[model samples]
Target: MLKGIPKIISPELMKVLLEMGHGDEIVLADGNFPAASCASRLIRCDGHGIIELLDAILKFFPLDTYSENPVSLMQVVEGDPATPTIWKDYRSAIKKYDQDFTSFEMVERFAFYERSKKAFAIVATGESALYANILLKKGVVVE
Candidate 1:
């Protein structure tokens, strides 16, 4: 294992993340996601839930500062002002690393899927919760 690397990040996932350029998006999705057909590269994080996998990834990657919403989630069909439970957890996890970031946006389910289809890669987690999916835009490592 490499120093500072999360063990949950497999070699394949590591390679994909390293190869991705700034602004490239990656999907951390639940088991119900159609990852096999949508993913350009798929990493199987079986038995791990969304938050766990997201926490691991945030250790290495920073959210893109250039974008208005560097993180995006699939919105619940009936829109409401209250944040979705999954989004709440995601916010907390992300803030653990960078507290200044508080922006999050939601897209229609199908629109989110279309966006995921173009992602650099998709990490399929074993989370059973409905709408437990998030897309992260990779930021540049500014010197």
Candidate 2:
């Protein structure tokens, strides 16, 4: 085991993060997401929650400063009553890394799936929150 690596991040997930280039996106897929169908590369983080994974990932993974919305989330369906309170947790996590981080772009459900298909990789988590899937665009590490 490495000294600083978070326990939540598996070797596969670490490798995928290292392999990704600036502007490439990775998905933290919720339990309900069709991750297998949407992912080009998939990493299973079963029995884990996205909030913890998100916090761990942001510790090393830089957000795409070039993109207005480096983070993206699946929008709630028109008639769905489920409000994703988890988003507040996401913002809290992001703020820990980027003080200026304000919001995430909301993609329509189908559009989110299409975008996920193009992501460099997807990490499937066991988070049970509805519409909890998030896409994070990679950024360069500045010296």
The best candidate by TM-score is 2
lDDT, candidates in the order shown: 0.86, 0.95
Per-residue CA lDDT of model 2 for 57-85, tens digit only, reads 99999999999999999999999999999
Candidate of highest lDDT: 2
- Cα lDDT of model 1 by residue, 25-44, tens digit: 99999888898888878888
Q: After superposition, how far is residue 124 of candidate 2 from its true place, in Å?
A: 0.6
- Give all TM-scores, in the order shown: 0.91, 0.98
The clash count of every prediction, one per candidate, is 0, 0
Cα-lDDT of candidate 1: 0.86
